[model samples]
Target: MFLKRITIQNFRGIQEMELNLAQPSGNRKQTLIIGENGTGKTNLLRAVALVMGGSDALAELLNTPDDWISFGAPFCQLSATLLTQAGEERSIQLTINRGDTLKGIVLANQDQLAEIDAALAHATQNYFVVGYGSLRRLNRSTGFSRGGETIFRQARATNVATLFNQEALLNPLNTWAMEVDYRTNGKGLDIIRQSLNDFLPAVKFHSIDKEKGHLIFLYGSTQVPLHLLSDGYQNMIGWLGDLLYRISSAFNDYQSPLKAHGLLLIDEIDLHLHPKWQRKVLDYIRHKLPNLQLIATTHSPLLAQQAQEHELYALKRTSRGKIALEAFRGTPDRLLLHQLLLSPIFDLETDESLAVEELKKQYESLKRRKDPPQGKLHYLATQIEQLPQNQRSNMNYGNDQLDLLREIKSELKARRDS
Candidate 1:
């Protein structure tokens, strides 16, 4: 259920990139891949999805074999080592030839392959739910073209989107109360309904039928269709639902003991989320899904800052057309970086002494030049001199002026640190 490591070769823009997952510790199970846009973040996710289920979900995101190879290179390869819940280890390696033919190889003992096959079969069922933008696009198109029937059909066809769609399909609270009765012991259907209601207060699903026609989702209270929630929301719900479904399936099998290891890969986890929400969302995932192994990519410095050192992979492109992934070290204070980046334009803090000395020098030089503009300079000097001791000692000016000073200070600090 968990991915121990992944080695990607000639996959899309990545000539070769290997990443290792840290073991789950305490209540947190998470790994964060940090990189700028177009630096193979999404490609990494595509590689995982492709290996996990061999689905077409990553088709649009991947380059064709011809395109994936370096300017004059050949073929593409992706491989990963995974540990399943049954304490069995497995490996998958996929290679694409120049003709676009894929050669897939799985390495494991018979029992491990059986487990991996089963898990992969289940994974394929819900793979479509992995991308939120795709759902939103489907919803918008369905709204105009098919009256939402297409959306519902597509969602159900890909089991991944069904939970969100199902959540949306439930009646409003008041309506459900009128139609459904609570059981005496609050078990059975009542428990299911209550749990659904509690876990999904903001979610609603609407369907309309024309006489004998099939039901279809028409509208939702949330801005997008249930399928079209923000990527963070979609990823959270989809991942949780997938885990729950797998757990339920495992329980039903009876023969397999409950396995604690699970692997999760997320790309651009900060997509369509604000900084504050990003932290909260990630924290929620880590806390709520403690036993699962998580590997995710992000461009948000905030996310990088929040992640543990062992859980971070910094991806950089080498001149030879290969992606080099290195474990991130040192304390990355994203907020401080943000402040320093903004300081050049706005002064978050000021040195009044330096300001006064500079002003005095300028004023004296202006007076020595016998400039008639001494009137304005004199007025500025008098204003500076009249400032209170505390204010004059160290002043924090407005953003516009403070920014320039901050940049200067940052450059000096960088030099000193180096």
Candidate 2:
């Protein structure tokens, strides 16, 4: 199933916002929302979880403050339109009023909706809706325990250890192997190994510490614990690993890597990621879970730019307190920093650095003067030369800065000669 659209009203920093996440025909299955801090990116993701998860979603919303009912607004409203795998359309809506509990409804064809509901209900049974917030939980593996009770709990995107253990793997693989004529355990290991290598080649899963409680990763010859890794490494590992476990747990279809179709809501998907990682994260997710509908927010332009125009949504809040989705046209990656800085997505008025902004102002000032003063012209040239070559190169707009500086110098010489 995939989400078609989501409408949010009076929620957190957003007064009203509507996002059409469905890809244009023939486009890929990824929707990326980008905005400055506090533009209700996180709120939008949380709203999706609540609407899709139903009763289980309520427990998570309890952490929201009472004042969550936007100031001067009576309540908050969140509605999502979903397209089921069977081509049926349904809409789920939730409302939260001040001094009252949140209410929700699903509107669709009864039979079609029931099937969709059953899938979601089965997801809840397997703890399937993966919510990965900014601060991901990290822990050392406490190894295997025979006779341990399997915790059938709603799975957070950060916690998938329960499903990664021997018990979880052995039980499912052995059962599948017995039913079929194939060795499922070996195949499962191969899938896990290949997935990890694809996502993070430097780190492979080390032998499980049955004697000691620790899950280790192989970095050369040394075994490293999850907590010991850098935050970026840990974050990616935590989310991607959990996602694999979820897919395996929810569906027995091993022929396809990820068989269960579920909603993946990630707040700040680029959090703690390097630029390299940011560029590849979405592609990796898409490759692994081909059918999973992904809704994610990111501040990284690298990540946002990589997505096709139809897959990216820019959330901009107007001065009057209304949030709207800005249209992203043309190929995003083709736009340089100067263009991106001015794009509606970033909404940058000037160069990111103060020195560059000053240089731009000086250039404009010199351009405006009918007969520019020698001192001002010389100063502008000197400032441009003083800036690093790469910095000046990046700051170039329609005209190259070095060429402009030379042109201004030639003009100064001609004026003196006259």
Candidate 3:
């Protein structure tokens, strides 16, 4: 099952917003949402979770009774268009009546009724969404819960763990040990190992140090404990391991291969990740779980640059203050960081650094004075040349600075020739 599109209204920071997220004609399974804070990126993810995870999940996500509605708005609505595993269209919608209970409906084509019903019965397994937030804890004790800190994680962890081992619901450490150990079934470990290697070529999964009760990831024969790794390493392991565990739980056999497909929603997906890793994470995810659909939010332009144009979305605020979606309008691969920073996603008016900004202002201020001393002109040209090329190329005045500098240098040489 995959979410083809989603519509959200009267939900925190979103008055009315609808996004058509169906993957374009391609084998790609990734979609990205880029927005500044408070643009409702997380809220958009929650709307999908509410539909798939049901009312209980929504209740836990909302705080106040009125939190479901936009400030001063009477009601809230969440809806989505879905594609069932059988290639049939379906929909799940929920409406919150202010100060009252929430109402919802799940609809399917008459021919797809039975199939959709069965899909709903195993909704968590069919559309498993791992909504990872930005602030993941590092150096977590080996006994950390599989679900992490969110209410959604806690509940899903319990539900899935119940299906595999009732005892694991109480002792999550058992789940952790099984996840790191290849001896259980050694079925999907190679796939996961390959994924990690693809993202971090030098790092390899060595083995579980059974006596020490820690998972060992190796760097060229050097043992690295999960807890002792850098924040970036631990964060990556934390989410990836949890996802593998959930996928494993779907089959009720740790050694058995994953037989389910689902969605993954990560906020600030680049958190604590180095730029190099940021560029590879999305591709690694696609390679590892080709069937899984991912909708993630990121501040890293490096991640955005790798996405296809159609797969990238920017959450924009209308003049009225409601949120809207805009498809990125540039060639993703050709777009550099400076270009991306100035895109609506980043909303930067000037991609120039402070030093460049100061230099440009000085140059402009000098130019407005009508050809300051030749020494000054030469000095400004030298300073501009010394600035980073990326910053220089993104100057606000476009090629005007270059032309002015060239003209000044020519004039200085002409005086000497005369």
CA deviation > 4 Å runs, candidate 1: 23-28, 54-71, 102-115, 118-261, 319-321, 331-418
Q: All candidates' lDDT scores? A: 0.47, 0.61, 0.64
Per-residue CA lDDT of model 3 for 10-101, tens digit only, reads: 88768787878764574337888888788887777766665555444444444354665788888777777778667787776776667763
Sort all candidates by lDDT, best to worst: 3, 2, 1
**1-418 in candidate 1: lDDT tens per residue?**
5666777887767877787663445222577777655677766765665555433322323324356554445767767776655656777666555556222222222232343455546753322113211122222222112222333333222322221232212112222221122222222234223223323324433432223222222234433344445555444443333333333333332122123345555556665566666665566556544555666777676676676546667677667846777765544443354442223222224444677757645655564675448466546556544555332222334555445344434544565598
| Candidate 2 local lDDT, 1-418, one digit each (tens) | 6778778888765777787776557424788889877777777786676555554435444344345568878877777787766767777666666666333222222232353356657654332455666655433333222111242233431222221222321122122212222336434445545556667746776543334434457888888865576666866776665555445545655545455676777778887788888888888878877777788898888888777667777777787867777767776767674666666668676554887768857876877789978687677766665665454444534445557656766766676698
Q: List candidate 3 segments past 4 Å from native.
A: 23-28, 101-124, 143-154, 157-195, 256-259, 334-351, 369-382, 385-397, 407-418
Task: Please count the clashing residue pairs in each candidate, in the order shown.
Answer: 16, 0, 0
Please say which candidate is ahead in TM-score: 1 or 2. Answer: 2
- In terms of lDDT, model 2 sits at 0.61
Error of 1 at 24 (Å): 10
Locate the minimum summed-lDDT window of 10 residues in model 2: 169-178
- Model 2 sits at a Cα RMSD from the real structure of 6.8
